[model samples]
Target: MTTKPDRFARWLPIAASLLLLAGCQAAKYRTLESFGIEKRDILGSRVEAARDAQDDAREQFSSALEQFRATVEFDGGDLEDLYDRLDREYTRSVDDAERVRDRIDSIRDVAEDLFDEWEDELDAYENANLRDRSAELLRDTRSRYGRMIVAMQRAEATMDPVLEAFEDQVLFLKHNLNARAIAALRSELDGIEDDTEALVEAMNASIAEADAFIQSLEGSS
Candidate 1:
């Protein structure tokens, strides 16, 4: 049986790695600040990147769905080539989804650091009126950020189910590359289309939220 110490030991390297990564990120931000690029600017840029990534992912999923549809409707093409095309679409969709997730993570990392620094620096202000105004601004910014991130996370959560459905269709067609497999995939085509539609809608909402958040950050600056 694994003891508590064994569990702790197993996690130690992961914990240390996280600390090292955090230190590196802090150093990076400091370097950026020295060049007059603040965390708010970084956050806004990351949000823009994540929004763009989601947009790309939305288009990718739509394309992948189209490829799947084309595969089901194949009348007399190279069956092997059709399968290859579907596999390629699935691979591309996976890569796009990964990019979207990475961009969201980067946004979250920078936002947290920005908020923490903002909160800590609030203690250094000697002017009462300025401090109160700054605190109020921070609260408003945090509230808006909370909404934006929730929208982003909602969109992110919809991705996996759609990707899984796509993977299933691709793998099924791979194993049974013939007319019958194409027919089998026809039943799943509508389901994939529906899921992709939902994912796209969610991504659109998230992208809108990111745009608004970036605009707000710019307005405040």
Candidate 2:
């Protein structure tokens, strides 16, 4: 028969081994939590960046449309040429904006998945403490908002020159057309011009709102 002391000693080693394994499992869980947080941050950043690019493209598109309208108002060297150029530029801008939008959508999907995973992991923990991780995620989100502001500014800068050119073309067309012809075109042209102005104003307002939102996010971060 085995001695009682020997049996107890043998059981003690096995118990210690089990405790060590449990500790390791806990460490692994923490590691996964950290990974999830980082993933959320990175994906959020990508979505913001992509949105910024899309906004810039939108501004360009608006500017191009304004230019096209202005060109039509004025008689130019070759109306056909002007129309062709406008069509090409519009097509290019649309393609770029669509591409950026698609990217943003993809990033959003990834962000949602990351958030879900994070939530699931957090729920699994009884005493989950994620304050630092949350802060990191907020900071990353703010960075993305900042990028959007920069993009809007860039878009505005690009639009100024285009707008000026467009205005000049309109003025030229107005000067060259016969009085009766101008009168005939005025009604249609006025409507288009008004629409262009409204769109530009709306875009400006959107930029301002976006800037304010970004500022708020930065303050929070």
Candidate 3:
């Protein structure tokens, strides 16, 4: 006898292939709907994932900043080894930033599909009163979504500056691995810290917006 988990495991790849063959965002959504999953559910899940990604990114950036500070303060040690460690931190930060971006893109795609479908279905209503109520609800939901996406984008924008700063410092150290380079980094440390602080603040605001949006979505369901 096949266990339920085993059955689900076997069915997962087939469902994924079907979604792939569906060929477009809207078509994929229809395929998912056939499996009893609604757009709102997918939107909520993606929002949660994006929020988690932002959280991970925040921690990773903070860790990278600390490593940078430590490297700049080095008095005597293997500078090459220090460069390698900082380079590793830079690489991890890049990966985390990419994950956040991918999650944001996924959220945007599902959100557009959900709103478009909702708007199109309004004309199918038989009762004017019901249609009016739904229309108002749709407007309100869109307004809240607008706020959430703006916050997410603002946070996303801040990430690039921080990453560039990290990359520049890492590259400079790779070439000029000496006490002079450490002194130069120390001078630039203030600017890096400022940028990172701004990033962390933006991500926190975005994460809060995500939480509020998810709660609103669930409450209405």
Candidate 4:
């Protein structure tokens, strides 16, 4: 008997391949509609994807910050090993940031398509009251989505400076692998703390927005 994890592991690649194919096919609106996925459902899924991406990003940033903190508190060690660890963290952080950016772009793309379709459909509605109600819903959804994306973008922006700081420190340590470098990093602790805290706060806000957006969708559904 195949265990759940074993079955999942066996099908993982197949599942991934199917998802890729589906995404390619779904690029066509007709394909999406043929699959019975509505614009609102697409938006909801995209929003959730963005939220999960943001969650991953927040955790990655926090992990990187912790790594930096550990480096700053370094008493004495093999400098090369220290650089290796820091380098790994920096690379992971960069990858996570890129994923977050891509997720946000996906959300934006779906939102634009959704809103355009919605607006065009509004013009097709014959009943005046229905048209008016749909227009109002479109406006409200757009406004809420705007707030969520803005918060997500703001959090994303904070990542650049933080990543730069981490890179600079890593590069500096790579060259000057000595006690002096550790002391210098200790001096930067306050600034790094501030940046990390700000990032967490922004991420929290974005997550709250995501929760609210999801709740709104659920309520309507």
Candidate 5:
């Protein structure tokens, strides 16, 4: 009974341990799939949402500007109320822009994480002689779209001051160009109308440019 143990018998425990390790690794892979699902795929969606918000804010701002211009030019009865409404709308527009910017930033962060994850997955697949087939690569393509949204937001922020100044000028003109002043310098007031036209043209051009930029970003995404 104390005879030498068979060599095959001596190796049985080692073989069993190897099988157990392989099973553990397989279970780990299944867990990984579940973990991956918890992380939502929001890259494309976020970019699109941000773009829509930006466009809405811009359109509202433009409408308010138009209303302000018309009210000031014609001495509308509700001039003061219209101006107040326009100011409030502008404030809301700025707030909306900030929200859009924040959303773009969030999307950018998630896109970066997605890119890293894709790279890791690709490398693993390659090392294991597997084909790289993951939709995560789409994140790289859409990431630039997120960046474009951010750029537009920066441009919008830069233009905000210019717009405010323009609005203030309109208010000043409206206040100063009452019926008495208009009668006093009727000819000069008529000339001033040309300047107002030019100012409105400039503002419209800016709005168009911003809109175009936003549309381009949406198309790219």
Candidate 6:
């Protein structure tokens, strides 16, 4: 005769499944850090990600500028190849800028959650002096974050006009593949050069701010 399964045996699979689900959720929603880390640590991680994104953007813009220079300065060396290079740079730049924008969004999301949690915890403090100090720190940190984000966003904003100019040049090169095209590009070289330079300057300022923000976080810890 077949015997019925015990209750413990029947529940074992369910319990294991629940545990697995919990692990997956923990890994997915990693806003809360491990090792009992607090919101500050999460903020630090976001800062690092933001810094990395900006660095990536800086490198991409630099590379795109180089390719753009190549396109304009093409001394009749493989016209098609020059167009190909410019097209590639334009596409890569769009992708890289998207990543930068996504990273900034992530930083903003985490900052909102972290600040909310911190503000809520302010009410849990029993000591008035300590509570006041925590409140002040919260404000200070928020202000710093605001400044850093503004710098990042300013840098990000500069990319669009540069990209627009690149797109126009690329389209022009795509159609006019001759000496006249080269001459046309030469005429536009100064304008493109100025835009790229301005973009680089904006990126440099943002990069410096990112470094300062990261250093502040490190110093805090």
Tell me how far candidate 5 lies from the true structure as C-alpha RMSD in angstroms: 17.9
Per-residue alpha-carbon lDDT of candidate 2 for residues 14-101, written as tens digits (9 for 90 to 100): 5435546555634533443433324433443454455566566666666676656555565546655655565566556656555655
Candidate 2: how large is its RMSD?
17.3
Best by TM-score: 3
Number of the predicted model whose lDDT against the real structure is largest: 3
Candidate 1 lands at a TM-score of 0.88
* Cα lDDT of model 4 by residue, 1-221, tens digit: 96433544465455545555665534544444544555666677677877888898889888888888888878877877877888899999899889889988888887898888889999899999999998998898889999999999998898888888999998899889887778888888789879988988998899899889888876765
Candidate numbers sorted by lDDT from highest down: 3, 1, 4, 6, 2, 5
| Pairwise lDDT winner, candidates 1 and 2 | 1
Task: Find the number of clashing residue pairs for candidate 5.
Answer: 0
How high is the lDDT of residue 74 in model 3?
93
Which digits, one per residue and each the tens of the lDDT, describe model 5 over residues 34-85? 3332112244445556556656655655655555445445543554565566
Instruction: Please identify model 4 stretches exceeding 4 Å from their true place.
Output: 1-27
- What 10-residue stretch in candidate 5 is worst by lDDT? 32-41
Give candidate 2 regions above 4 Å deviation.
1-37, 128-221
The local lDDT score (0 to 100) that residue 21 gets in candidate 3 is 88
Off by over 4 Å in 6: 1-31, 34-37
Q: Each model's C-alpha lDDT? A: 0.86, 0.52, 0.90, 0.81, 0.49, 0.76
TM-score attained by model 6: 0.82
Model 5: CA > 4 A from native = 1-40, 76-78, 127-163, 166-221
Q: State candidate 2's TM-score.
A: 0.47
